[model samples]
Target: MNRLSDKEAIDLLKHGDILELGQQANKIRQEKHPGNTVTFIVDRNINYTNVCLNECRFCAFFRRENRKDAYLLPIETILQKVKETQEAGGTQVMLQGGLHPSLPFEYYLNMINTIKTAFPDIVIHSFSPAEILHFSKIANKSIKETLQDLRSAGLASLPGGGAEILVDRVRKIVSPKKIMTDDWLKVMETAHSIGMESTATMVLGLGETIEERIEHMRRVRDLQDKTGGFRAFIMWTFQPGNTQLGGNKLSSWEYLKTLAVSRLYFDNISHIQGSWVTQGQQIGQITLAFGADDLGSIMLEENVVRAAGTAYQMSIDKMVNTIEKADFKAAQRDTEYNIIRRF
Candidate 1:
């Protein structure tokens, strides 16, 4: 099949029949993954601190430094979480937090080093582009230098957070103080250039138009074509509860339609993960038929979505059941998308 053009993607997203789009997407997914297997990772998202400077409007997780509830977890606490993750059979630790102002650059390096030192087997797929940019400024170094420093300190990969829309118009409205489109892309590109692999993500219902969503995917696809460093493309709906950008959630139909379009658009990307965290299990199950080959993260611990007032719990048994009931074999994967176990 010809690679989807920008106009073609936009047209499919805007006007194509949802079922047809899903069928096309599922065909592509099956072509890439002929095994009829769906994967999930046993990981934890340990938000070390809620204190932030770039209080993005769409987030309910961040707090000002002086806020009574704001916190920066001690290195001991972070290590404890990593210990728990290891005990719980988790292979990855996603150590994401807000942009704390007073924390020195060495704080992050120490955090990564300490975690890896304590848990040598755990994959530290932590940090975001926004955090990287913040670290660069804090360390007075270039993006490459900052990433190199982190990588040397045992940072395994990055999570595609803080890339809500990846268009400046929407970004300026939702997160005026956060890193903009070019900066986010540059951070990812630089990370890729240094051999650090990562995932790409999109949160729908951020008030971005169809064209802008396609544009976001275009940038990611173009970069993947160059570096081939992105292991997966994960898409989810924006949870609006308790957020400053409070609004109704986008319909699951719309979410699935866009997801199918993403599967079609990102021909160069490998995995398309369904977000059971944001959309619940039923829709997450439906995502398999719509082109998703993986249900991301049996996230052992997640607070960001809970802070936004959306919470869904999943365990190994539940995750396996969710996938098996959908008629696909369920397996646990590591940070690199390597199958570690089968159910």
Candidate 2:
């Protein structure tokens, strides 16, 4: 099949029949992954702190430094969480946190090093490009320098957080103080340049036009062409309960249509992950038919979405059953998308 041009993708997203789109996307998925196997990762999102300087309007999780409930988790507490995750048979720990102003560069280096030193087997897929940008300014280092320092301190890879959308117009209205589009791409590019792979993510219903959504994918696809660094593409809806940008969630129909379009648009990227965390189990299951091959993270701990008043729980048994009910073999995967065990 020929690559989808931006106009072609936008047209499909706007007017293509939903089932037909899914059929095309499913065909592509089958071509890439022949067997009826869907993968998931057993991991935990250990947010170290809730203090944030950039108060994004779309976020309900962050708090000012002086707030009574704001916190920075002690290293020992974080280690305990990792220990619990390991005991639960988890192979990855995602250590994300808000951009606290006072913590020195050594805080992150020490945290990553401590986690790695204590748990040598667990993958530390921590931090986002926005946090990396914050670290660079705090440490008086270049982005590349900061990334290299973190990588040296045992940071394995990056999670595709903070990339709500890649269009600056949408970003300005939603998260003006956050890292802009190019900086996000730059951070990912630098990470990929140094062999630290990461995923690409998009959030729908951010009031972005269909063209803007396709533009987001276009940038990611262009970057992947330059650096084959993105391991997967994950998309989900914005939760808007306690957020300053509070509004209704987009329908599952729109989400699935966009997911199918993402499958067709990101032909250069290999995997697409469905968001059970935000969309719940049933829709997560249906995403399989829409071209998603992985259900991301049976997260042992997640607070961002919950903070926004949306929460869904998934256990290993339940996760396996979700995949099995979708008529695909359920398998546990690691941070690198390597199959760890099959159920």
Candidate 3:
């Protein structure tokens, strides 16, 4: 198989032949994995707090400082969630929240330390690029310095949210107040440099062109080529409900095409996760044959993307059943894409 160049990659995606692309992607997947197993993680998105200062246009989750619903989770409540996650046999806890200006730097460090202290076995894959960019502003430190501090404080890796679209023009229109395109990449690059790995994600269908999406993948691939720390690449459609930019959602078919395209393009990224949370369990099952090896977390609790009106419930058993129904073996994994259990 020839490695498709950038232009060839974009052309194949824009051709809009999902079935053909999916078959091509499956070939690549078989060649790479040489196994018929699908993987998922039983995890919880423990949104530590929702009090954010940066009110981006596309978010419906953040509240101002004085909003009645704006409350921070105390240390005890967080531990309680961790206990529930442990009991549920979860191996990952994704801790992400709004960029609250006053939540001092120690607050995040302390939170990670406490989560680690209580549940040392559970992988803590918390904090996205948005939080790190916010932390840099509040702590008056470089992205590298902030990441170093968090890494020392038991922060294992980052989940690439707030990277709605790495194109600044699109970002300016949607999440103008969020970190710029370059800063987002800078944070990830710095984290990779220091040995902390992360999974790359994209919220497509935000009126971005095929070229822009390819460019974003290229950026991720280029960085991964250098550091080799990225574990997986996940892409989902933008849910445009209860937000200022109230556009239609991307159909599951379109989402699959893009996901398959990502698998074909991001050869350096070993795993591609399917988003049952955003796309539903059935299409997510189809995505297994469309170049996705991992079904994303069975989120015990989710908010931000849910706040945008996409709350798809997926239990651990259902996730496993769906994966198996797709004619592949089902396995559970941890945050670093490590296989934990096979069934």
Per-candidate local distance difference test: 0.93, 0.94, 0.86
Question: Per-residue error at 123 for model 3, in Å?
Answer: 1.4
State the number of backbone clashes in model 2: 0
TM-score of each: 0.99, 0.99, 0.97
> What is the TM-score of candidate 1?
0.99
Candidate number with greatest lDDT:
2
lDDT of 1 by residue, 1-343 (tens): 9999999999998899999999999999999999999999998999999999999889999999999999999888889989999999999999989999999999999999998999999999989999999999999999999999999999999999888988999999989999999999999999999899999988889899999999999989999999998999988888999999999899999999999999998999999999889999899999999999999998989999999999999999999999999899998988888899999
State how far residue 28 of model 3 sits from its true place (Å): 0.8
Pairs that collide, model 1: none
lDDT of 2 at 300: 98
Candidate 2 lDDT by residue in tens digits, 1-343: 8999999999998899999999999999999988999999988999999999999999999999999999999999999999999999999999888999899999999999999999999999989999999999999999989999999999999988889999999999999999999999999999999899999999999999999999999999999999999999999999999999998999999999999999999988999999898999999999999999999999999999999999999999999999998899999999888898999
> Candidate 2 or 3, higher TM-score?
2
Q: Model 2 scores what on Cα lDDT?
A: 0.94
Full ranking by lDDT:
2, 1, 3
